[model samples]
Target: MASSTASLISLQSRPSMAVARISTAKPVQGRSFLSFGLRAIPSRRLRVSCAAKTETVNKVCEIVKKQLALAPDVAVTGESKFSALGADSLDTVEIVMGLEEEFDISVEEDSAQNIATVQDAADLIEKLVEQKQKA
Candidate 1:
């Protein structure tokens, strides 16, 4: 009898945890409302479209191939590595600079060093563009 009542109370409390209700009080304008009583504010994520990503990759590839002076016979895909494409350190730097000028975004030194493949450069460019738009 007592144990059954305790179990019922626990079950009822569990449902409250599952369902969330917004308070009737309106949140201040231009501010995000917090869910439940959590202290951590959730961050808003920027959504990137597939077409935008593809366009970035194509543009990056074009810059890389042109900067490296690669022949048209050579195919540059996302998986193609900079080294395999005959891009040395200087060429890589030039390519990064070209990307900056084309995308109108600054690339940090650490991030520039991390780009080893076409896909990597494209992904970094996309991220930089997204951050720029958000700011």
Candidate 2:
């Protein structure tokens, strides 16, 4: 019985190495810095309210694309935020201003400070829009 237990422990401790015979491995090309794939990985992204997520993502992407001098059709969908868009402090301020103009609303300097990402801006704007519409 002891020998059987010992055998079981030995089996558990053993590493099973399955050799996969490689046929061909194409080298992955280095991705461009502006590529959206870098930020698509969820662990690297920011979280925001569902109501504002989509619009905010698109707006932020627009800002990034514009800054990078990309054409109008440039895609900026979900998962892209200020950091992923490569926005700096001045750019953030400009983006917030643009958002204000787009939404036709007032975003106070103090209130704007609390915003950290495109999602944050979108959530705030969405709530503000809802409040204004209700009123």
Candidate 3:
């Protein structure tokens, strides 16, 4: 009985070690293959659009700063949340209005409510702008 119990523990430990090795090896190999395949593809449009999105985020940061009456030294970035920057609900609404006016894009009420961070606003603005351009 003692021998069987010891053997069972060893069996469990050995399988866990093998599982760890297999899991680590699979992700490394898979990631390398995926990265190589992705690099082989030409993606000019994706690169251009990513640059444009970055510009949009920067613009959103500026607008948020201006709307909140933040001091020049107060840093606003893509991750900056409006509430964290001392903006109340009303201030957020005004910011949305300001963004609409500046971007010349009408944000639906649902979409406006979804703008929590500068990045969220920027992404929403980009999507709205694309839709507007398409129409």
Candidate 4:
């Protein structure tokens, strides 16, 4: 009975390797321990009603035209492709940067790379704006 009790005590005294592995990962400086992989959503929210979505699309169209230096005669519709609008890769990058600045939202690299048309960008911007508002 004493030998069995001693073995149980020894087992309880040993630290868990799984716990050690978890504790080895240091938390990022200036962030709370519970905030791992959690991004802070800004308290300031943007209006994201349907009307606001329409406005966002209009604003995006204007920004695209301005960024690409498109002639006023060129009609930019939501369906208009950026390449068809004479925007190359560099131009697209600039346009995306402009959208980020205009909308006050950060676009992930993958999302930014996938935008191909005016509608795509408008839709993405609308979604991000809504997400920001929710956050």
Per-candidate TM equals 0.61, 0.50, 0.62, 0.60
Which lDDT tens digits does candidate 2 get at residues 60-86?
557656655656775555445666656
Query: Higher-lDDT candidate among 3 and 4?
Result: 4
lDDT of 2: 0.59
Best by lDDT: 1
Q: Which of candidates 1 and 3 is the stronger one according to lDDT?
A: 1
Query: What digit string (tens of lDDT, one per residue) describes model 1 on residues 79-102?
Result: 789999888999999999999999
TM-score of 4: 0.60
Q: Give the clash total for candidate 2.
A: 0
Q: Poorest 10 consecutive residues of model 4 by lDDT?
A: 1-10
For model 3, how does the per-residue alpha-carbon lDDT over 44-76 read when each residue is reduced to its tens digit?
333222233788898888889999999999999
Best by TM-score: 3
Q: Candidate 3, 35: how far from true, in Å?
A: 43
What ranges in model 1 sit over 4 Å off? 1-52
Clashing pairs in 3: none
The number of residue pairs in model 4 that clash at the backbone is 0
- Enumerate clash totals for all models, in the order shown: 0, 0, 0, 0
Candidate 4, after superposition: displacement of residue 56 in Å? 1.5
